[model samples]
Target chain A: MEKEIKHLKYFKVECFKGLESVELNDIAQFNIVLGDNNVGKTSVLEALLFDEHPFTLLRRFYSMMSFKGLSSNEAKDYYNSLEFFFSNEKDDKVITYTVSYNQLQKNEFQFSIVDTNGMTEENIDNLKNNTLVDLSQLPNTIVLIKLNGMTNFYTTDINLYRQKKSAEISYQPFIKSGLSYDNDLVQFFSSTVNNDLKLRKEFISNLHFLSDEIAEITIDSTTVPNNPILMVLFNNNKRPIPLFMMGNGTIRMVRLILEIMMCKDNRLMIDEIDDGLHFSKMKKAWGIVLEVAKKYNTQLFITTHNSECLKMFKEVLEDERFEKIQKDVMVYNLFKNSENKVLNVDYSFKEFENAIENNIEIRG
Target chain B: MPIKIQLFVEGKSDKKFISDYLDHLGLNDVEIIPLKGKGEVKNIPAPRLEKNQLQGVKNGVIIDADKDKEESLKELKKYANFNLFDEIFFFPNDRDPGALEVVLENCMSSTKKQDFEHCWFQYESCLDNFPQGFRGPFAKSKVYAYLESVSPVLHSKFQGIDKVDFKDSSNWDLNVSYLDPLKMFLTKL
Candidate 1:
């Protein structure tokens, strides 16, 4: 199997947010993060951005900080610009992070927060578009540099983000959304499903879990084929309804399906992975997720506060097919120390199920 | 986190009896997990707590020492696995010339015990050739008969057979010599 891009084998963060010196060892292909509220489950996902510049990471981090909605324009305030760092103030604040190839077999570069010396509207525009903007060129913008890759997202000009979006790469992210506008998600969703048979088939099969009446998925007649607005066709209805007309559970499922099918050699991170699905269908949803994710070789990281979700995931992974790759799946239960920082406990598959069956309250 | 203990008992009756005994001994943080039946306990693995969760969490099972103690112990041993169960105890003390009801019978007052014997003799005399080799110790039937002789009306209140107090409320007490080993062993855990 030829991996198109280097996968993250291990990660460690020091002096970043409430997470101080957090380290995850032997990370799996399919990983899950569980903890109580505000334990930084989403923050940890944001930290694993794998971006070339800090600004893109910053934009993502800021959007995430606002809980998936741009409820605030703190990104525009220079005084609060650096508040994203630990302690919400950046006076000589520097966050150091390291990524390694599988157990740190090969060391990855160090990216630091540097002074913003130069400022230009175009540079900011390019960063927003996830295009290559040289950190060296923008001596003014917060940037990340790879020690061995030689060129940063700014220099080598590789907008893997944009390239992924265009090439249907899976690095799709479903950050928190609280009645917020998501231009990228909205844009990607509307344009990608037109005349896509494979996508429709996958959507139909996955949608059946939510409603047996869903017979078809297609673009709304109001929208032309070229500029498609996706819709769902129920078995009993003569006319199809716009996909958004359905509940959040339907939307979450379709979004997840699209990401799984589109991403190859990429990854996905979802917050509250089990928000709307019933507990009975949770195991089925995971089966589809595992099937499609593996079909595309997509690495997945999701966070859940639901125990039934974890229990079902363990049920699906119990198949002998997942036995060898069971090592590729990991479960982490996050806890807060007395100092009010996050820490985690990793359980092997067997032990995890054991804990759940015994009702030990691992989630809290 | 403080240590947690899980007990896989045969059924609710075993749980009720053992829990009451544990309560009398002043133990805390012990959870009774009823497997619903002895067969389930035999089929299911003992709850092996993770050492990483804390330093001293422990788990085990409590089951009946049904007639034929040797065979019962043999089957119970099948549920035992290394590192899964730190302890295993048979009801009415590890010794099994009797069951939990035997312990209940022992805890009765001297006068009640004599009356219980008389009721047992009368009930046996009324039987036309009881089941072959039925020497004695029909624990359950004898207790019910003795209670009925004590009060036919209050016998109607014998809701849970496992919780029947052989003596009136003021004289209630478990026979320590009959219960000490199991109690001491549990408290130590």
Candidate 2:
């Protein structure tokens, strides 16, 4: 049988975050990354988002730093946050993330920090004395992005942090843990599924595992004028309740399903996919995810620390309903080697099934 | 400090047998893992050994020689090429070409051996009267018959071969020479 082609066939990361060096080959459509905490499961997801235009790359870089509670509107603080993105083991201060869409095409992005020693003593003293220094008048630290035989540089300016630009390249939605349900959900729903009845039906049917009472979902701007809140109409004909009022698991599942629905023919990366979900819901959750991913041809990359989640993944893949795409799954186990370098061990579908069935420890 | 040791066996029967033997040797810190079958001995240990590599666990495997010692060893070495196992020992003293049943047969008492031989001769004669020959595994059949002869009530009450306590003196002599290689392997571990 011929193998199914995936959007990302290979990936490699050198000097990014806590990962010293790591490479993942033969990437599958549905990949699960397992490792100990701080072993760089989230780093791999961050690297996948690196293959973007320079503007979007800068936005993503800031977004990642903000995720770590390092957000700042000042130019100096933004420059300080760049120190946390590189690996501590290397002294040269260069980071590279590479990805291959197919065997013949490869894209590599290299990032390096440039020092600005041209600031005069008087200018530095003025910046220190002032509450908000004008970025146009000061020498700033610049980040150079080189990709596809092109180079672009962005300075640590307030405007770079304030500009919100959508990605011009392929869209890959990354759903992290504790994601807030905000206007993005409203815009995504209203633009994509609101006018299409088939998609809305599919979304509601997939969410039935969370609760059958979720009869319909909509964005209500009248409840809080100018603030559109996602509301759910239950089957009991009661008043619509805001999505934030629902349980954490329900909100997480809703967000996940929405992304999966919007992520057709693209890739989606989810961290700690079983974060707020109960063990009993894993099987149905996996079933819905696999069905939607297969239907839309969207590749999936998910991470989990729960063994029950792995077990349910194996069970759902082995299910007779998913026999066709059973061979499209892979599990990557990451662990630090004897030399303290991060390494990954890939397991094919059969090998993963064997390990799970025989009670072997592959989660590291 | 003593090194932590982990031993992998083929099935529940092998696990029970080795667990008792290790206990007899007074080595209790060793962990015995029973895999699904012989094929899994090649498939299951790489990831686990890598996971525990930092802990400095001495990993090893105890498997049956089956029909050929060299063939089994060659196949295992191919799969276990990760340099994980500290040692790999085959059953029936590692040099022989048989399974746990061979060791059990060797441990039978000399006095009962004569009685069992006579019963075996009579059983073979009874089977010869039927033109179709007996087609079961010879060593396993002999071990089961020997267990039944030792105590039919105990044999009937136990569910499987793995549940039979090898600690009973009447079942087998644990001090036999056929088990010295396994004992030495455990001792070294």
Candidate 3:
């Protein structure tokens, strides 16, 4: 028999954003992170977006900045946005992220910003103009990505990197807080869910929590030339309406379900998972997420501050219907120690249930 | 202002008893947290202590010395980080192999104590010759019988140990020496 390969068995972040250093061991398939405001709950998810390929890793990093409303089309604004990923307190200006799939395989990603003033003019011109520049000679405010013993660099100016071809490999999906429906949803629906009958049925069934009237979902590229809109067809004779016309909760759930389905055999991270979700629908939403993620073999890392969301997660995991996956779920409470270092306090299913039932303050 | 001291107890009854005791000591800063039962005391306190320590709050736990006194204390220390807590005291004077009921029994007034002794003696004598042997941890029953003997109508109306006021001098003497150890622990907090 072959040994099972967990997606991420252990994770560690050092000097990334607000996290001075943090480590999570024995990572479960479904992890729920809880913390007070500004405790680096989202940073943990961002740190896990690293990849062995530098281009894919950089694309994910740019996407995260864009999601946080920090991405900019202007050169200076983009340079400023990149600074948020590094720590201000450290002089070295290097951020390290490491993850292990199992005991035998460990991957580390190191990112550092360099200044071009110390380098020769030829090296600076090459870094600014060329697609593949020498790693030894870097330009001003450029980020050098080191992964799997390979080195690649990207200029801080957004216009420079925009000319480079996009990475062909797909990275893990990170569904950020307050996420709105975008073109990615339409692309995923058409490329993955639309072609698969089983996935299409599962998607529609999950949407019944929003409205049982949703009979089918289709793409409406003809309604608007050169642009595609997701339309929901109702069970009644009423005409189809655009998916965006629905409530924020409905749109958010669709994006979440689509990403989970698309990221099969990969990890998916969602920050503030209960942003647009109502307390009443939380349990059902969790049920769909857990069931779908398990079916697709997608590991999950979700963060939330809402106590009601935590309660719902507890209730869903405790249900006998989810008993087989109960042991795979874990809750982690992130808090800062006296020295301002972020620490993780993880609880297994039994421990988390105990804390919730007894009203213990596990969300620090 | 945030509470500076937190004390974890076993259940609501224990919460009520400890709250009243803290009031008698005039300690206003201590917050009492009641868990489901002894099982939670072993599991819940460490995480809570870690959280509280982050906020610079002092933590302590007072659990019942059920079955064995030293073993209970040892188990608590084994599960929870010992150095994180300011104090860890067991109920019933922190020395005996008993529970809160033992402390309540000792706090009974002289007249009620005599009545409790007579009542417990008769009850034990009645069960002595029974076919089903009464393996006894009858301290709780003794305390209930003592309360009923004091005021049967009032005791009948009470639902749980928490409802019985320990401050009433006619039923209980709050200044009893058995509670001195617990009082000293609170004063330190």
Candidate 4:
């Protein structure tokens, strides 16, 4: 059975003094946030994962203290609470659930329960064993429950994935496509064939065929001799360059197409997917992203300002290719109100287009 | 000092047509400047004098009737309310500014008895083409087009023909564009 975040019935968000009691209700899975500049769209995203505080997860994705709306005191309290908020369960050896916020008062923060039976110790161990493990083997489902006293507020179960044993040799878990490893991946290919030459040629040829409208790409095995590497020439006399030398959009396309061909479980989160691309290019980008998402069972969360991004995504939804991806995708338009308060309005394609055409500020 | 008649136009084609037309009219003291879009309203030079100070500007202002003519007129009234200039003229066309090319095509076809193949081709043939990005057109084309089709009364008022030394050369060197009539209307303001 496919899993999806059906609806965010109600959400009570708090981070800074100004944004202490914002609420959102009746959220569709694919909701859009629309608003003018300086609205707290990014804040809401952070509020969900972190307890309105900066964490290692936040640091890895974006800079700390980059966003405003919180006082220095509140920011400190949010960081301090992470230690007291969650700890390992003693007897059951599972993570205990608790919800804490400024409004709840000291030690008065209450939480509801949600079971995580499918996430067994074995699966957790398998997930966190390798330093470079594929995120696919990680938890796919998140359970949320509403707190008893806090109306319209919910908390999700948090479980840490830890490895039980440690091998002396640093072994990277390489999920193969049953094809020969590219020379770059050959070191990690245990007992796999050393036929990198054959696979590399096929890969470049396949990429060339994919972009038939563009010139054919040639694979020169002698120069770099790396696995998953393609040297493509644009003109007859010019020096050939690696495919990576192309812009980030092209590189992203290359990686995504290769992953789709491989058909592996890879969840991709593309930040600013519209970077270095025009409106016309974005349609094809959306198509490629969806194609990869379907072929690899990958979940894609792309943040973009390009209207074409939404247009193409809506096309994917209407066509119903991986019809579920549409249900899985979300769009949020963040806007600042006349009061300088930030609000987010979630909308589908029709609502968004209508609002845009009519000059209606739809952010709530 | 020569009086600078700064004419802000909507686009390159309009600018070119207006500039050439004005130059032909012997308005050597006038200078035309094109503001490409409504967005450039902010950058249009404000009065060099302080608010509630100095005398009003002697220069004239002309703006297109714009897409939303009623709203544009209201805005122009507010714009002129500052008393920055003596006059502001709005020409509300039935269609977009690009329709000038079509208007020219229809006029030329009626007078010459031959349909012009392409607006771009005819425009290129008539006007001095600039580099890739320089925007301006043969200023006199719009007036020439208007004069060819408009009634004689409107023509005489808008296009006051000058005395000719030679036969057809009079019309050739003459200010054939409608800008003189536009300026004539502005001179009263």
lDDT of each: 0.61, 0.77, 0.78, 0.40
lDDT of candidate 4 over B135-163, digit per residue (tens): 45544455454344332455355433221
TM-score (chain A only) of candidate 1:
0.74
Q: Write the per-residue lDDT of candidate 2 for residues A10-120, one digit (tens) a residue.
A: 888889988877788888899999998888998988777664456566677777877788878886787678788898989867788777888577787777775647657
Against the true structure, what is model 4's DockQ? 0.02
Model 4, which residues run further than 4 Å from truth?
A1-37, A43-241, A255-268, A311-330, A356-364, B1-189
lDDT of 4 by residue, A1-364 (tens): 1133112334455432234334544434333443333455434443333221112222311222222322133333333333222222222211212223322332212222223365678645543452232344333432222233332222221212112122211221112112222433323221121234553454444455336534434445576545445555654537767765676556555554554333234222343456655666676666665665454454333455555566665665667564565555545555443354445445544444433332232332
Report the candidate with higher DockQ, 2 versus 4.
2
Judging by lDDT against the true structure, name the best candidate.
3
Spell out the clash pairs found in candidate 1. A68-A176, A116-A140, A117-A140, A118-A140, A133-A154, A134-A154, A170-A263
Off by over 4 Å in 2: A1-6, A118-138, A148-150, A165-172, A178-202, A205-214, A224-228, A234-241, A245-247, B1-7, B19-32, B42-60, B70-87, B101-177, B184-189
Per DockQ, what order, best first? 3, 2, 1, 4
Model 1 Cα shift for residue A244 (angstroms): 2.6
Query: Can you write out model 2's per-residue Cα lDDT over B41-152, one digit (the tens) per residue?
Result: 7777355676556556788888889888998988887884437878888888899899888887887776787789788978877877787777644567888788666744
* lDDT of each residue in A1-364, candidate 3, tens digit only: 0123347888888888888888888888999888888999988999888765565666676777777777667666766677888887798778887878875677877787766677687866654554355445443567776665445455454544443342223334888788777776787788777878987998888677557888999999998988899999999947898988888888988888788766777788998999999899899889888877887788899999888999899899888989888889878789876677778777888888878888877887
Candidate 3 regions with alpha-carbon error over 4 angstroms? A1-6, A119-138, A148-172, A180-184, A195-202, A205-214, A222-228, A236-238, B1-6, B26-31, B45-59, B66-87, B105-175, B187-189
Candidate 1: which stretches are off by over 4 Å? Answer: A1-16, A21-26, A37-40, A48-59, A66-172, A175-186, A195-216, A219-229, A234-236, A310-329, A336-342, A356-360, B1-48, B51-178, B181-189
Is candidate 1 or 3 superior in DockQ?
3
